[model samples]
Target: MCFKHDRAVGPLIEFFPRYCIMPAQIISGSETAKAIREEIAAEVARLKTAHGLVPGLVTILVGEDPASQSYVAAKNKTAHALGIHSEQVTLPAATSEAELLGIVADYNRNPAIHGILVQLPLPRHIDEAKVLFAIDPDKDVDGFHPVNVGKMMLGERCFLPCTPHGILELLQRSGTETSGAEVVVVGRSNIVGKPIANLMLQKRAGGNATVTICHTRTRDMAFHTRRADILIVAAGVAKMIKGDQIKEGAVIIDVGVNRIGQTESGKALLAGDVDFDSVVGKAGAITPVPGGVGPMTITMLMKNTLQAAKQAAGIE
Candidate 1:
């Protein structure tokens, strides 16, 4: 039985009969995200009433990629729902790099727009690095700016990359202990892996863990994985980690979201890096694919935007 953290429960042992295996506790990202959104909504209300400040977020989409369009739309809708001044700029595929940079500059200078996010995977002609560098670090709520990245490395107070930040939130809210724990992250991507590894090693409330990151070249992936007290898998492959690779009672945070196949009605079937069925039985707590880290990523972006707005208005 996948026990949700929010529901009332008696003794944990009572739910499992003698000789029967107990399923991993389900760390519901959807429920956690909802609770965080409520907190943010309350804070937004207070910020408006006390200081007359409303958070503002602007998301820029360079092309007509279906996935990017949908992601940007969801962000705008969430911003509006939270009483933020949300703006969506949809440019043609042929939009010049110079023109895009100019738009970012405009938002950077505009005091009303506290957060600016440029959707990733720009068109072939555009230099992705140059576009990211053009964004003012203070307004880069997506936390992709070099300045923000550097500050994050130094453990300074800067907007963290949303997905990694969300992972930390999940660990924190789920009551998973990180201090001195063995954390093995199975990817080195900048967005998720590197940042998360850095976060896990930092001397903070959600950190102070011994972290090891595995990548494509790792010779013995299972060896390292088996040693982990908490395993974080972000490799894009579907169901890569199996039951035998993890330590017993390890906390599993699966970050991979792959479209494996479609359902009978034509909906996409999603899967994570860690094989859910095989690992769920051994894990002490685990996050499910669809309702896991995905929702928390957008929620953290909203959090960063709110923080940016507060900083701009000189309101702590």
Candidate 2:
């Protein structure tokens, strides 16, 4: 029952020393999404009246990954619904790195466009890191650029990554108490795992939580997960964690988006890292996959776009 390192032992002992199931709230994203849209619409209206121009979000899609295409399409549709102008630049799968970088540069310089996001998981032939670095930090609404990442790490003011930021929003809107809680983030990716951990452990709002991050190499993942008051799974595995793995009453945030085998009709189904049906009864709170973290991601993008606009226009 002891971890090798004292840093690990300290938190493990101080928090999650006992396992007990707590009452959970299953938050559907529809209500959250509707409220977010209304808030963003109000913000947009205020910005337009104050600055005389609306914020614009430009998304660059290089290839035709069905999932990525659908995501971008949804983003565009959501932007319009929220009264934010959206522009998408679609390029062939064969588009070179230079071509993609050039497009990002154009968006960076365009005064009318306040935010620029390059759809992720670029073709294998392209260097995603190089392409991401080329985007100006001011216009990097996706917050993947190293500059923004560093800023977030240092606890400085900067654009937070969409998914992590969305997770914070979800927890906040749900009235979850982050301070003094034991939060286990089950991923190490810069996008969700690291950023979220940083956010939860910060000294400000949504911070002050003790955080532990587990990954493929981590020993006894369940041991750590069951101890967490707030369990965030982003491992990209389908139903990898089961209800028995979590303590009763633990708050679960499923960030995984995995497409499993087709149904009897040959249509694929989506699932989260946690087994929803199994965990629902035991968890005090849990987020469903398709409607949970997914929708919040795009909503955060809209927020970042509006922030980028205000920053670029010196409107605070």
lDDT of 2: 0.88
Point to the candidate with the largest TM-score: 1
Q: For residues 1-316, could you state the per-residue lDDT of candidate 2 as single tens digits?
A: 4343266566765575454233358876657877988999999999878778799999999889998999999999999988898999999999998889888888888998988889989999999999999989998889899999999888888889999998888888998888999999999998899899989998763678999999999999999999999999999999999988998889999999898877999877889999998999789899987889888889989999999888888887
TM-score of each: 0.94, 0.90
Question: Which runs in model 1 stand beyond 4 Å of their true positions?
Answer: 1-18
lDDT of 1 by residue, 1-316 (tens): 5344344743444565443467999999999999999999999999999998989999999989999998999999888888888998999999999999999999989989999999988999999989989988989898888999999999999999999999999999999999999999999998999999999999852689999999999999999999999999999999999999999999999999999999999999999998999999889999999999999999999999999999988888
TM-score quality measure for candidate 2: 0.90
On a 0 to 100 scale, what is the lDDT of residue 245 in model 2? 95
Which has the greatest lDDT?
1
